[model samples]
Target: MFHAIPYILSLIAAICAALPVLLLEPSRTQSAGEIRLVHLLVTWNPAITAILLALGLVLAARSFFRLENRAARAALLIPVAVLGLGTYAARVNVFEKMFAPLPDPGFVAAHQADFLSPHDLVLGVSLGDESKAYPVGIVAYHHIVNDRLSDEPFVVTY
Candidate 1:
């Protein structure tokens, strides 16, 4: 029951998303590969994650009512507690996501190099649309150029 309910809920969500993907495309103002707002809203990973999490939570709560043994409740509570904490974390993060858009997938895929600690290395490079937060005022005592960030495969000159 725990597993089956989540799958059913996800199926319903997919159907909901599909309606917008098909029906809403004609109404969009932009042309080309522009991402539609409906696309962004309905297909956002967080939205789907929230749906799945809610369904799982409901299932968990349902199980709690059916449980008999005290030990069974204790075992179930561990996962339930973790899910609760996870849901809380996801909720807090979801609002933050809408403001700052996800980086372009092409930019991310184009340059998929692993990030290294830049402060230690006087010379380091980061390519693609991947972002690495480097400590300010801690960069190597050398030349640094922040303007080269938009040149295709961006190279942070430092």
Candidate 2:
């Protein structure tokens, strides 16, 4: 039972660390009332993760000294390694992976009738005689699009 302490602590630490990355975006889409609850959790995730990591380390050190068998000592390394890797992953900016900016996106010209939906939202940009429209659906996913209009470079972001 004593040997399980480190692993349990590490598991909790990893979950706390991962919650913000996994839930932040989904929370944004929630209703305003529920968003406040989610915001609280997201805001405190970092502090919670830090505390859990500290506790896990302390418990891991205590367990290491208490275990006498060589095999049991080696088993403790598993949780230590998991905690290390989980901490590294938790520190990464997950948005950098999700929202990849588009560069030199291809466009096709069309008549007004080509867009069947009258309610479609688009981001329209005009530079002198050149004009472009980017659909909001695509922009919402990638967040950023790089394009050139009349040889002038521009970036559009949601």
Worst 10 residues of 2 by lDDT: 19-28
Per-residue accuracy of model 2 over 1-158 as CA lDDT, tens digit each: 87798899778767766666555655356567556755665566556666666777888788889988888888877778777766666666677776675755878785753753668788998998999988898888888887889999888889
Candidate 2, TM-score vs. the true structure? 0.55
Q: After superposition, how far is residue 46 of candidate 1 from its true place, in Å?
A: 1.8
Q: What does candidate 1's lDDT look like per residue over 38-157, in tens digits?
A: 456444635664666686678767766777867765566555554444444433433234334323322233245345343333333455764443333223322233434436544232
RMSD (Å) per prediction = 14.0, 6.2
Give Cα-based local distance difference scores for all models: 0.47, 0.74
Model 2 residue 47 CA deviation (Å) reads 2.5
